[model samples]
Target: MASMNNATEGQHDPATPLFDAVSHPNSLSKQVTRFFGLGQDRIENILPGTPFQRDVMDCAAKDGQRAVGHVVFEIPQDVDTARLAAAWKETVHQTPALRTCAYTSNTGDVFQVVLRESFVFSWMDWTSLGLKDEVVQDEAAAAVAGPRCNRFVLLDNPDTNERLLIWTFSYALVDTAFQERVLGRVLKAYKDAHDELPRQLETPDSSQATPEEDPNPNPNPNPSRILKIPQVADMERATQFWRKYFSGLDASAFPPLSPPLTIPSPDAQAEHRISYSSPIQRKWSSTTLCRAALAILLSRYTHSPGALFGVVTKQAPMLDQHQLMMDRPTRTVVPIHVSCAPDQSVSDVMGTIDAHDHAMRQFVHAGLRNISSTGDNASAACGFQTVLLVTDSDTKRAATWEILKKTE
Candidate 1:
C-alpha cells in the first residue's frame, strides 16, 4: 500500500502543508499524506502552507460537507492568468461564501483547482442528528478546517493542454436538486470576471427556437443549446409537449423495412446500428431525432416521453480535426438506459428525467463523474451513435440531413 517512490524524492508525495492544515481530522487528507509519505517540497509550482491557499481550501471543504455538486468553466484561449487570479481574489472578498478564500498555490500563480464558497463543509452532522457522539469535523484549530475530504493531485493532460481537477462533495450539499443552482452561479462569477464564456463545440440560441408562426420546422440545424429546467415544476406539461410531437409523426411517410433497421457498421469500432428514415422532409437534429425515436419507443411501453438529460444541451462548436485534438477531450455524450415498469406512465418519465439524467450532467461536467465509451449491448438499446446531428443552417439546402452515424 506504499505509494512513495525512492527514485524521486519529492515527486512521490505532492501533498503541501497548507493542504494538510486546511484538511485535518477528517482522516481523508491525513490518510493520503501518511499513505504516500508526502513531503512539503513535492508541490513545486505553488508554495505550501500559504494563508490565502488555506482560506480557499477551507471554503471548498465547507461546501463539500453540504449536498454534492460540481461546476466547470473553460479557460478561454486568450485568458490572462494574472487578471483571472486578481478577479477571483476580489470576488472572494465581496462574496460571503468566498470571504475566507485565498490562494492554494505556492508561487502566487493561478492554481488549476478552483474552490467555490459553499463546498467547504462536512455533510450530515452525526451529533446534530442525535446519532453517535462522532463529529464530522470540529471547527477548531488555526489554519485548519474540519470535515475535509481527501485531496487528489492534478495531472497535466498534454493532449488538450488542460489540467484535470477532481474531488468529491457529499450527496447532501450538491445533488441533482441543487447542482444547477450552484454551478450556474459559480460559472457566471468566473465569466463575469473573465472576458467571455469558454467556447463550446456548438452554441444553440434561445431566441432561434422556431417562432410560433415560423412554418419552417428546423430553425437552427446545428442546434446545440443548453436548456435549464428546475427539478420539480411543470412535469405534466413537458411530458405532454414531447409526447404529442412524436405521436403526431406520420410513420407511414417514411420508409419502413422492419421492426429494427440495422445499418452496416460504418467503421470497424461498431458492432451494430439502427436506422430511422423520415419522409416529411421537415428538418430535425440527428441527436434530437435519435432521442425522439427512443422516446417514441419509451412512450409505447411506459406511456411517458423521454426528456433530455441535464445541462439541456452541452455542445462545443463542431471542431475541425485539428481543433478536436487541440481542445479538451471531454466526451459530451453519455449513454443512459432506463427500464420502465410495464405500466409506467408519463409521470414516471418526467420524474426520472428530472431526478436522474438532467441532474447527473452537473457531476459529469464538473469532473466528479467518470464518463467513457461503452461497448455494451445496453447502450445500443438506448440509441448510441457516433455522428451527432449537424445543424441544417450550416449545411447545403437539399433539406440537409446532419445525422450521427455509428462506425463499425
Candidate 2:
C-alpha cells in the first residue's frame, strides 16, 4: 500500500505507532503542531448533562451492576495491536459520546466532561490461566466494571486461533444506535491506520445532525433530545407542553414499587440482542405493538382504563461522521401516556396509540422538562423505565454495511 500521509521532517510518523500514548504536545506552536502533529490530546468542550443522562447516572450508581453492553468481533491473526489501540484512541477523540464521562458536583448537578487525555491502552491476557471462553468473556466484561462508556478488550484462544474483540460500554449513554456509529469509526480508523493512510481526526461544522435514516422525520429533534445548544425557547416550549399534558396527573399516577430488574446472566444479553435488536413481525409496528400491550397489561393490573408509561428515544446520525451530534446525550426518556376506549377493538386501540405517538413526538424536544414536574422527575422517569428502543432491521443494516465497505 502506498503511504497516503504527507508529512515533512521532524514530524509525527503516521505509520509507526500512530498514538503517542504517554505524552501531550511538546510546547510547540499551533502551526508546528498542526503541520507535524500526532494529534495532540485536547478536549474541545465540557457541557452540562441533559436531564436524561443525569437521571440514568444517578439510578445506575445506586443500582447493583447493571449489564454493560458489548460488541463481539472476529479479527485476523496478523491484525496490528498497536495500530488498533491508536485507532481506538482516534475514534474516541473524534466521537463525543465515547469521550465523555460524567460527574455530579457537590451541589448535585451532573456535568458531562470530555476527556482527550493521552491514550493509555491497557490489555489483560487470560490465555495463560487456561480459562474457557465463557470465563474469558466474563473477565472481559469485568474489566469495564464501573461507569464504563468505552473500553476495547481482546480475548484470545491460541488453540483455535480464535480472537474476540469486545467493545464494552454502558447502556446509559451508548445505546444500540450509538454503538454502531462508534464501531464504524473504530473499524474505519483501524483499517486506515493498517494501510498507512492519514485520517483527519477533527473538523468543525456547527450545523445540527442531518437525517441519515428518515423513515419518518420529526420536527427539530435536536431540542427534543437536548442536543447541541438548544434554544431557551425550545426548552420553555417543552416545559409548557409537558405541564399541560400532565395537568391532571401527579407522581401518584405511577405505582409505588419500582419494577424488578433481572440481573445479567450468560447468554441472556446475547439472546436479547439477536431477538429484540432485530425486527419482529407484528400487525402494528413494533413500537405501536409494545405500547398497546403495556397499556393493556397496566390497565388490567391497576384496574384502570389506561396506562401511563415512558419511552426512551435514541437520536440518529446513524452512521459515523463528523456531524453536529458528536457530543451531548441524545437519548432522553419521554412520558408516554396511553388510553383506549372500552368499546375499542385491539386493532383500533393500536391505531389510536400509533397515531398519538406520531403526533406527540413533534413535541418531544420542547417538552421533556415538565412531564411529571421537572424537579426531580424520578417518578416520571420510573413510570416508563423500559426503553422500547427501535433498531434497524437486519436486511437494512447489512445493506448499509455493504455500501460502507464499498466506499473509497
Candidate 3:
C-alpha cells in the first residue's frame, strides 16, 4: 500500500453562513404580512385573537382540531356599490388591529382583498349584529364616533371577473375591546350599504320598444320549506344544564332537521346531534378525546367505524340561491366534511380526522385563503349538507343549517 499524505483540515463554526441562511418567507408568513399590510416585523403585534383564534390555538396545542363557522348575505339586484365600499372603508377605520393599511400593494387584487385577515375580521363584526339592533352607538367617553356605516359596493373593475366591494375595516384598529364592542357598528354599516338603493331602481320605460320573452326558464328552483334543527347536547349533564337555564322552555321539544332536507350523506346526519364542549378544543385534547369517546359510543350503537360517520361543518352565506338571505349577512358558506375510509376502525378513522385537524392547524398558521378561492377541487369530496349549527358559543344557541341542494 502507498503511504497517504496527511493534510491539516480547517475547523468551521456550526452556525449557518449568511448566504446559506437567506431563506424565503413561507406562503403563510408572506400572506399574513402582505394581506394585513403590516411590516414583516409587526405581523404578530396586531393580530386579532377572537373566537376564531381561540379555536385555532386550542387545536394547535393538541394533535388535531375541527370546527367551522360561516357568514351569509342577500345580494339585492341593483345593489348599491358606492355605499358598500364606504361601509367597508369605515370598518377598516374602526378596527384597531388593522388600522394600518398593511397590504396596500396587494389590496386592489380581489383574491388578496378577499383573503385579507382584516377583511374577515370586519365581516365577523358585520355578522355579529342582531336584526333589530343594526348599528351600535359610539361611546362618547371613548372620543371615537361610531363607525362610519356605509353600503357595500360590488362593482366590476376593468381587471377582475368576479365582483369586488369595499366595506369597512380595510385597515387596522388598535383596541381589541373597542373592536369587539363595535362589531355591531360594522354590520350596521354593511346593512346600510346594502339597503342604500331602493329594491327596484327602475330606469325610464322605453316608449316604443317591445321586449321579447325567452322560453327558457330557470332550470333550478328555490325550496319552499324552511328547515328547523333541534338543539341537543352530547352529555346528559350538559343537556340538563341547558334545560335548567331555559327554565320556562322545554329544550327537548325543539324542532328536528325537517324533510326535503336530506343530509348530504348519512355520515353527516350523525353530526346533527353532536355537541362539542370546548368549541376551540384541540383534536387530541380532552375535547377530541371526548369526541372520540362519543364516536366510539356511536360506533358501538350504530355498528360502524368513525370513518363510516363524519362531522358536517356548516357555513351560512349572505346570499342564498336566488336572493340575499334577508335573515342573515352577506358572505360565503363553506362545509368542510371530515370522514374516513369505510374499512378503518373507529380509532383509525378518528386518527385520520385528527390528522386533518392538525393539517388545518398548520393551514391556518400558513395563512388562510377564502373558501371561494380554494376552488371547486376543494369541495369535490362532499357536495352540500345540512348540519346543526351553534349560532352562539353557549351551546344552547343553535340553528338548522340548510344547504341549497341542486342537481348539478
Candidate 4:
C-alpha cells in the first residue's frame, strides 16, 4: 500500500492509525443495529461495543485479568493440517469479528473496528511437542497483546482416529454462538478441500509470518489491554453507598418466619405463583409497581417493616463512565434490600427501589461485587428468596434457578 501512488495516499491520514479511526479510506462500512438497552445509536462501521465487553476489558486493564475464552474441538484423524489451516484462514477472511479489535479514538471515543488488512490466521500445533494445552495457551496469551481468534490443532493421530482443535478467542470480538458458526464454515471448507487446499499458510513461527508494520498504527492498538480505566472514584463511591444500605443486614439478621405450609422435601421446595394487581402508575415501571406490592404484602405477612428480593435486569450498571454499546450478555441479578416501614406510604418503598436502580446504572455492579467479597455464606446471606425480571421484545432474557440441597 505504501508503494501506491500519491492519489491513493491522499485518501487517508498517514500519521494516524487508519484501521482504528472513525473514518477509513476506500472501505465498505455498515451500521450495527444491535440494541444494548442504554439507548445507544449504532453507527456505520463504528461500534462502541457492549457493556460486558467493556467491563471485561476494564478488568484486564485494571485488574490484570484478560477476558480470553478457549474452547477445545475434537476432529477426525487423517485430517490434513495444511488444508485445515487454509480453511480457517478462509473463514477468518469472511468473518469481520474474527479480525475486529477495540480502540480509543483521539477524540476520547471507544470503538471496535475491523482491521482493514487481510486477516492473518495464526495457529500452533502442540501434538508432536508432547506439551499440555495450558502451556500453549499461556504462551499465546503472553505473546498476543492484541485481540485475536487463534487455533491449535491435535493432529496425525492413528489410534483413536481423533484429533483436537483448541480455539482461543478474545471476548472483545464475538461470543461463543458466533464462534460456532465460524468453525462450522471452516470444517465445511476443510471437507471441500479434501484433494487440494485453496491456499497455503505460513507457520506462525516462520520469519515471513508477521505482516508489515502499519505505518501509523496507534501506539496502543489493543484498547482492551491498554485503555486506562479511571473508574476508582466512582467504584469507591458506589461501594460506600451499597455498604451503607446493607450495613448489619444479612439473612440471619432477618426475623424468623413461620414454617412452610407444605413440608419441605429434599427434592423440591415447591413454587407458588400467586397473582395480584395494584394501580399502575405512569411514572413508575411495571417492575417497580410489582415489587412494591410484593414488598408491602410480605411486610404485612411477616409483621416486619421491610423485605428483601432480587432484581434481574440488564442495566449494565457499570455503563455510565462510557457508552458501552456492543453485543454481549448484560443481564445481572442485583439484590434489592427494601427497608421501608409498613406505616410509611407506598411511595416510600417505590422511591427507594427507583433510587437503587438509578445508582445501579452508575457503578452498582462494582459496589455489589465489593459488598459480596466475603465468603460464600456471607454471599448466601445477602441473596434474596424472591426475584423480579422485566423484559421487552428489544432484548432477550433468560434465568437459571439453582436450589442448593443439603445432604444429611
Which model scores highest in TM-score?
2
Backbone clashes per model, in order?
46, 3, 49, 3
Q: In order, what lDDT does every prediction score?
A: 0.28, 0.46, 0.28, 0.46
Per-prediction TM-score to the true structure, in the order listed: 0.21, 0.56, 0.26, 0.42
Q: Who is ahead in TM-score, 3 or 4?
A: 4
Query: Which tens-of-lDDT digit does each residue in 90-146 have in candidate 2?
Result: 777677677555544333434454443422234445466543454345434433444
Model 2, position 308: C-alpha lDDT score: 66
Q: After superposition, how far is residue 327 of candidate 2 from its true place, in Å?
A: 7.7
Question: What lDDT is reached at residue 109 by model 2?
Answer: 38
For candidate 4, give the lDDT.
0.46
Name every residue pair that clashes in candidate 2.
224-365, 238-366, 238-367
Model 3 lDDT, residue 342, Cα:
52
- TM-score (C-alpha, index-matched) for candidate 3: 0.26
lDDT-best of 2 and 3: 2
In the order shown, the candidates' Cα RMSDs to the true structure are 23.4, 15.4, 23.6, 16.1
lDDT of 1 by residue, 28-106 (tens): 3233334323321221111112212222333444453432222223243354433333333333323322211123222
TM-score winner between 2 and 3, please give it.
Answer: 2
**Candidate 1 wrong stretches, greater than 4 Å:** 1-84, 89-233, 248-408
Candidate 4 lDDT over 303-324, as tens digits, reads 6666666666664523333333
Which is the winner by lDDT between candidate 3 and candidate 4?
A: 4
